[model samples]
Target: MRGELSLVADCKVVRFDAAFDITRETIGAISDVTLARRDAVTAMRRAFAELNGADVPIICLLRNTSENGLRDAKNLGATCCLSAHTPPAMVARTMMTQVIQDRADRPVRSIERGVARATEVLTRLFDGARSNGPVALAQVDASLEPIIEAVRDGGLTRWLDRVWTHDDATYQHCLLVAGVAAKFSLHLGFSASDRNHFVRAALLHDLGKARIPLAILNKPGRLDEGEMTVMRTHPVIGYEKLKAAGCDALTLGAVRHHHEMLDGSGYPDRLSGDSIGDTVRLMTICDIYSALTEKRAYKPAMPNAVAMAILSDMKGRLEDRLVQSFGEAMGNGS
Candidate 1:
């Protein structure tokens, strides 16, 4: 039965002498549906739910389909609906394409869903801050739970390896920064609580950017002096917002100082050297790396080697120890 189920997972023309019987036998298998009647969709959905595969994409074939057929396909999470008269090879090709596409899209969809949830939390925080209402740290913790879980589960690298962005650069950028920051923290011997705090700071480091105008935020080209000045206030803005919401000192420090350079050249306070602590230094490295690697309307993303080289060149601006640490963690042969 398991071998038969394996065959079904790979089959382009899936058939069931009796839909209920076959579905009962094929738990945990993803199969193309070359044949299904109106009632079959509901039965399949039930079976898929039982198999813990409710979201699995099913390819449906029918002699003729009405609006109800389409609705049924949607309910069953069908990937495509094909005419029964379609040639076997064509059906096979179509099913294969859908299977490949579904596999590719899963990670992307996961990122999108995660980003959307995180954005909702940020939006609410921004709205509350604007109104000067009390915001709870518990809410922030709840909002970060999914991101923290993904990072801890060793899934962050899988998400980052896929070169795509579903939301604005800010949301995607923050998520990547947190992942990198968490990774760096692990390498630097941070305890679990310390790592979570580090990741939280990375997540909210750009909250101040929300106060900046959208015009400047999304601009593809260079900003003039005035716009640049406006752009640099994000760290302070983020810090104040988190502080008002009762975030801890570490988070506040990272949010405010992530942009501060070691050479007294950064924005807001512009403190240099030891004034910027190790946590901020770690955040800065991750923040810079994520920003450089991300695609923007004005510039294509640089390769990792190129970005690392650029970071290495700015030795005085960034901490040498942290840069070396980051490079070690992220280095490949190139």
Candidate 2:
């Protein structure tokens, strides 16, 4: 809601079908609209309310409504209209197009999901690393297998790559990290356990970034000295948060030292070379690549090729072998 007015908002494509989902207050010509249909007036109120202040134009897809609905929507202030019979997949494309045309916010709504599902299961396992809980590890193994296979055959990674482009800072960064880490692991010929390790580490590497003030993290320009110091502390902040939570060792290391480079130039302990754990090294590569490629709250994304070259140039700054592996992986597939 705030992004369009305040930050780098994608074009907004609100699903109008759920107008009455909140209040059967949903009425009007959109009753038959099944895909995203709920109530028309409710949809209008929410959409207009959001678009009222945002400079970005609204794209209202009315594919689910009747002819009367169309007239009603226009009368009510819908900008564009489509038939209820419009293909959902195509609707998705249209919404994305609208966002690109205006360079407004993305069409996806914030699906408020609680920390449940198997991802949480894995999170719990890594969270309680000291327990040596095989249960969490086993669940993760079973769950990640399909994900690994998908990426190997070029499924999950591609999907992650696609969605990563349009998500919020945290979601986008995590996906970017997951993709790069998976590719790095595959290139390293890691076993399933090692592969899962990279996946977990990459995904959760900056979970603590969620705790940082958005103002600091999303600063479009260069950070001033104090802000820079605060930003640098994210690793320690995330690390301590995890430590206090009693997370697993590898997970803790991932959150703590993903910023630390093989060269002493990294942060926190400033440990260089072999002192930094291998998992952290891999995550460092993932973190850098993902950040460079993903769009930020401040600006558009950097091209993959350009990002890769930068990483390559930073070889001496990171683990030389890890960089080589990462480069090779990128060259081989994506």
Candidate No. with top TM-score: 1
Evaluate all candidate structures by whole-model CA lDDT and list the values in order. 0.67, 0.60
Model 2 spans with C-alpha error above 4 angstroms: 1-143
TM-score of 1: 0.64
Cα error, residue 180 of model 1, in Å, equals 2.1
Q: Report the number of backbone clashes for model 2.
A: 15
lDDT tens readout by residue for model 1, 36-66? 5545555666655543442345555655488
**Looking at candidate 2, what is the lDDT of residue 261?**
71
> lDDT value for candidate 1?
0.67
Candidate 1 ranges with C-alpha deviation above 4 Å: 1-113, 130-136, 143-145, 151-157, 161-164, 332-334
Model 2 scores what on Cα lDDT? 0.60
What tens digits encode model 2's per-residue C-alpha lDDT throughout 1-334? 2233223322232355443222222111112223234465665666555453242434455544777766766665555566656665554455546556543221111110111222454455444542433323345444454445545655333635454554356656665567667767888899988898778666667755655677887677788998888888778766775566556898888888888877788888898887887778878888998778777556776766788889989966787777777877877653
